[model samples]
Target: MDFTDHVVVGVDGSSTSIAAAVWARDIARAGHWPLGIVYTQGMAPDVREMLGEGGTLMCVESTLAPALVQASRTAAMVVMASRGQGSTVLPIVDAAAEAVLQEAAGPVVVLPYTTWNTLDRPLVLGLDAERPSPASIRFAVSVAGRTGARLKVIVDDKGQGPDRARLQTVQVLTRVLGSDLPETFDVEVSAHELTDALLAKASEASLTVVGSQHARRSTERERSENRLLLRLSTSPVAVVANTVEAGQADGSATR
Candidate 1:
């Protein structure tokens, strides 16, 4: 199915979910696309009023993961709160969010309960120089272009020289973006761990994007890293799946 029509957000009547819905609404509005709110049960009247029009509300009998996965099949992207409904005192990624991130056909955005103070910050991207995903790079550039936001690409050196890491990043970006690169973007090679570097960058960013390989299932280490990133990121984190397989050429942007 073509995935370029609507922005779908999963809500559970919680304030966190409502915040995510509002974020999704703004994205839909900006892109001139329709918005979809998927919930399992009844939603509050005030919440519905806040969301307003140019969207559809869908109630699914199943759990949040299945509902979001079904909606993501045709959506440009799927969004959800980092923690929802029965969250505990300790901050952790909700089960449903984790499941959807792993199984969703398209990108999955996880919004934290804490709201960002401003929208002028750059769009941060955590890129792996050794195994860069063209889909992720294209998605970040597309969002940066549409929002008129600067793009900050972060790469971990992993003991390599900063110059070499930056060079690798530039090569991958040039190949992926070609002439369609964002007007303002810079590559930052960090010596710290990937998760730590992203956390620091996300604190001052409007949004942070990372890539997840589209596979049968994620390894334990990958799952742990994803959970850590989602649990601590100060801004909304977008986990874009690398739809293009290894040894295959990159295709057009899905969004």
Candidate 2:
């Protein structure tokens, strides 16, 4: 759909969770999308209280869901986090979110339940020499579109920037429902070092998306840059798993 669509945010009711909720509210408002707050109970007492016998599971979900609907452009199930483990570390949060916001996967801005942290905005998707997962791009685009946030894809790849490979990725994005592919999308080209350029852009953007290179196959250098992004970038980070085409063995796309 459009950026006016809704975004699904995960919370844990912890201070961090609350912060996530608040952050989601702001994003929703900016993007003109309804905010969805889901409280995870992967921990304990929290989920138990919500689902334990003589618990308030039904009552709570009913009350919170509708109330959220009222106060927010639209609110949804505010249940305790569930119990599980899978593709993600926070399986509970992931599962609960997948259930409530299926087909509504515009973007899932995860606000970790870590204390003493500020939520960042104006998401910056780091364009790697290696292409990002199509699914990840789809998710990122949805959030960017909804928030009316500007997108800056960093092409830190060497060689000719994988011209052919990147072109296909670009082609797919153009077809997506919400893509503001301006003539030039904050393009960047770096030979080796990317600290200065990345820091500069990260400083301005609210978020950054980095392809999560698996250690099993990553070179010492690739691993180093990924770590650098985590430590250097000032904005919140979204680590996307590798999903580039075989042709683009190196991160760069040469058109």
All-Cα superposition RMSD per candidate: 3.6, 11.6
Q: Which ten residues in a row have the lowest lDDT in candidate 2?
A: 246-255
lDDT scores of the candidates, listed in order: 0.74, 0.41
> In model 1, how large is the Cα lDDT of residue 219?
53
Q: Give the Cα-based TM-score of candidate 2 against the true structure.
A: 0.48
| Best model per TM-score | 1
Worst 10 residues of 1 by lDDT: 245-254
TM-score of each: 0.87, 0.48
lDDT of model 2, residue 197? 58
What ranges in model 2 sit over 4 Å off? 1-5, 40-122, 159-180, 193-200, 211-233, 239-255
Candidate 1 lDDT tens digits, 1-255: 233456788888778888898888886665456778887676745557888766687776767788888777667678899888887746567677777877777677889878673447888999988877676787777666655668899999988889999888888888887787655688888999878999988878888888766632655213566678888788998877788231111122323
What lDDT is obtained when candidate 1 is compared to the true structure?
A: 0.74
